[model samples]
Target: MAYTGETIDVDATLQRLNKAASERGFDCFSLVEQDGTVVPYFTRAAKTESAPRIYLLAGMHGDEPASPLSVLDLLENDLLGMGVDWTIFPMLNPAGFRINQRENHQGVDLNREYKAPTTKEVKAHVEVIEQSEPWDLALIIHEDWESEGYYLYDLPTELTDGWAPRIIEAVSRVCPIDLSDSIDEMSAKGGIIAPRLEDIDTEPKLMGHWPEPIFMHAEGKIRGTYTFESPSSFDFTTRIQAHNAAILASVELLLGSKR
Candidate 1:
């Protein structure tokens, strides 16, 4: 089925993101050009060397409109407060977002382009990652249309213990949790899917397809990562709230650890 949900006004959204990033003292850069539109990314450094480096990404799937909206809401409210270095990729697939499709205009699923990175968007995103220092935690906000409640895919490392529960608890206040034992064909427990590290290591690197988390893990560039999935079947507001709560919870946990 085709995506008939509310579509994003890409130009207006970019303008708002640019303004917000500028006001928040973030350095904004154009990652790539797609159909004459420049995909933008933003970064804010920490005040101290001990501060945790966090990265938040959204809007990889154009059909999932709430992911990006939630990020913008957080930025507008200055939720990325002091004490942490942040890198944000607000929207990764502008061409797909322009038409409310999952894949880009060229029919490429940007999320799966990380391994091969034939698309300019993924290539440019990879460039940014290579240029920056490793991140302490990375959150990729997304939506699952077939899900009945919120779920998350956790890429565990030493720093990730007890985080999924915190995120689930926080999001539960705003949205229901996907209690299924299996999500996306993988075993899960209480809406949290913590895959074995060895499984990730032995996973085949299929050509032209690697999710962002997989790519980051394979490159050994991030200490931990979580992919939050809000059910798109629910109201848009609920989805946004769930995403925001999950993201904020992640930040709080990471920051609290440093204290």
Candidate 2:
């Protein structure tokens, strides 16, 4: 089903996420516009200065409302209780979410503009990543319709033995991990697709025609990077739940790794 092009007040959504996080004793900040014309990117860190910072960003593409909604679910559930500093941008393209469009107000793909951030959305994301302490891990929530199943993109990281596989298994319990066949289809388009929950031991290719922004920004400093793609082919509610599952699983895996 096509997403209804109705207005989604992402600012309101951030307000809800912030309120919930605050009530749970988390440190929260919203980098929003003054006039409320744009959707502001908000980051929520744990109250205590913690070990490794974990960043979760969603809604780079306007049409992908599920990403932001999924993150909201985590906030409502007090998922941050799991630990690690969090920098979450629930919706990068506020205008796009309002109209269910794929790009930002400038009609530029925020994901593709990371190398040269053209829109305010990309700039804000860059600001958070650069300003925050070196992230130990990052999980960006995304959606793709051309694929038949869910997928993940594992970036080059230093510690892969226990961390990567744990994320894959955790996610797979909720959604079937895309096999090599699905990966082939996505690779045909350019890069490997994560049809189901998956991981990569080696560093992913970070430079090419359409390189990943996370990897480009988090090359040397970050310990791990991953991308979660929930297929829009599934029902919206199911897709949103899948996104939440991935987020929950990632947090658990990351926190468990430290122990």
Best by lDDT: 1
Q: Residue by residue across 143-205, what tens digits does model 2's lDDT show?
A: 876556677776545553445556656666666555544462345222234322222212343
Error at 172, model 1, angstroms? 0.0
lDDT of 2: 0.63
Candidate number achieving the greatest TM-score relative to the actual structure: 1
Clashes of 2: 8
**Model 2, stretches more than 4 Å misplaced?**
1-12, 32-38, 44-50, 180-185, 188-212, 215-221
Error of 2 at 29 (Å): 3.2
Model 1 Cα displacement at 37 (Å)?
0.9
* lDDT (CA) per prediction: 0.88, 0.63
Tens-digit lDDT track of model 1 for 13-38? 98998899889999999989987888
